[model samples]
Target: MAWQGYPALREPGGRQWEASAVAWLDGGLWLHHSLCITEREGTVDVLTLIAPCTCGRGYVDITLDSEHILMDILGDLRPTHGRFPHCEEPLDCGSVHAAPRPTGWR
Candidate 1:
């Protein structure tokens, strides 16, 4: 199931992808992925997503403090590596190796 229904942006940088390199910061199931919003029928929920990487380097996901929550402009909440995580406060970052994400998330 290749992230069914969620909108997917191709790696902007065209670099080979590393699976499991990214994940939700909270350690839940498939929380960091481009989500398949079945309720909206094919709307990929970026809610709680990583930042839209223009550089094409994937970053790890980390929990944003309640104050750090963005208005989900694209979908839901996001902890993006956007240029402005400090806008909110108590920001966090992810640290993981470049490897395929677990198939469970797939």
Candidate 2:
């Protein structure tokens, strides 16, 4: 589904990060600053923000319960990959490679 008027996340200092990706899985919503992989377990939602690591071999995986928390995580990522580039066309969330695994699969 195309998100109409997709929301942009603003840092406490007022910098804005446009949604590069967004999705709804198992009744929970997600917004990503960059390309991401998502998974859900019962009531918990885990998102892996891909390619923000300077090492080029690392990724940040986080579990969040609110959009604010997700925004905070994205804000904290500024130092890792610098400011997010302006998205000309956001990725279709439904097309994102969200692979749901069994609980405790690691």
| Candidate 1 wrongly placed segments (more than 4 Å) | 1-48, 72-106
- Overall lDDT per candidate, in order of appearance: 0.37, 0.42
- State TM-scores per candidate: 0.24, 0.32
Instruction: Pick the TM-score winner.
Output: 2
Candidate 1 C-alpha lDDT tens digits along 4-101: 34333335456333222234333222234333447657754443444423223333353443334543422232344342232322322323324454
By TM-score, how accurate is candidate 2?
Answer: 0.32
lDDT by residue for model 2 (1-106), tens = 4433334466565655554455532213333434333454243333433322343332333446577876776677555443233333444222234444433335
